[model samples]
Target: MGDTRGISGIGDADDIGDMGGIGDAGQVGDTGLSDGPGQAGDAGGADDAARAEDAGRADGSSGGETLGGRDALLARAVRLRESGHREEARTLLLTLSERCPDDAEVAYQTAWVHDTLGLEAEALPHYVRAIQLPGLSDDDRRGALLGLGSTYRILGKYPEAVATLRDASAEYPDDGALRAFLAMALYNTGRSRDAMEILLHQLATTSQDPEIARYRPAIEHYATDLDATV
Candidate 1:
């Protein structure tokens, strides 16, 4: 329920292949993989407040090793987002995106930073661009798709959300949570039958998962109300 939704996991480059499920608190799906928001940098303090701190640091320094550069930029973006200086963060990310055009991580983080700042429209292209980058692991691609789908849902672009989620679900067929998100997207799009099917599949496969069970009521409500509402 935080500003950034959870996704899969995060680790070094070698672990990208095995990364699955959504990220922990403060993490959001970036490439269908679970990654914490501002994963490459410090993420202390409360949401907006932490972002402000990061922005301050980003503005102060720009020299470092490769990892240091990424971390510094990420810190700046988070801080700018926290401080409600979304335009500044966007500008900073734009520069980074240009500098690292081939780096999917940079594009993914840029898109997510924008999403966190509530600029869904602005975030979409970056997500798409990141996903298209070569050498991106499946987990990363999945995370990006999930992020894009969720952003679309927030923008009331339900059909796009459904499509994007469907694509992700196909890639990660065993992920019940991914299916659940897809169901939610479908429900939002007035696709009650499809949504119910996805929900049923998720429930059948994850009967013991309290998280999955938590969605039953909402799914049921959507099913029953389909005709009258959506």
Candidate 2:
């Protein structure tokens, strides 16, 4: 539901399909992955905001190190982002990332905010740091992977996108969103057949449309062997 303007070489939202269900929420199949040419970097929507609010409300009584009410600041940033005050959120997150350079959550949120603002180039390092630093939750790690790879693609870094997406797909095999983005990256890299194969396989197994369902077996049969004879 965010601004979905297209970048050069990347299709608009209608062309790329909605990627709101990529990571942290659940499997891509569970969310009904859509098809398209572009990838949405907004991985988790309300779930992210809710989680940040919950964390902010925590008393931090646990033995974990509290960097001067880091949770509260992170929650504030999430609120700003969810509320569509992205410029304010980005500025705050930049400061937070500097103050809490070692905080995975801060780095990840910083990257996400940057991506939402169409600053994918600025987001790269933060996404990498979030993934590299300890303390990132498993769900967030998955989201970061998808975000990083999709960012790479948007920036015209095709090889990097392919590599990052492939690894992400391998790690989260059941995530159809990963495969969908991976397919896009593959197509950009001139592997149209491979991309179509991935899309076909996903459609065959996941689609609920009556026509696709009726031809599921045939689609599956041709998924990998697109050039096969009858």
* Highest TM-score model number: 2
Tell me the lDDT of model 1 at 13. Answer: 35
Clashes of each: 23, 1
lDDT of 2 by residue, 1-230 (tens): 12232112212333212222132223322322221112223323333333333433453322112432344345545656766778766766776686679988888888988998888999999989988999876677778888889998999999999999899999989888889999999999999999999999999899989999999998998888888885
Tens-digit per-residue lDDT, 1-230, candidate 1: 01344322223432332322222222322221223344423332233233323433444632222343444444455455555666655665676676577778768767877887677888888888888887556666766878888888888888888888888888888766567878888888787787886666566455777876778776555555455653
Rate residue 60 of model 1 by lDDT: 61
* Segments in model 2 whose C-alpha atoms lie over 4 Å from true places: 1-65
Q: Which lDDT values do the candidates have, in the order given?
A: 0.60, 0.67
- Model 1 compared with the native: what TM-score? 0.56
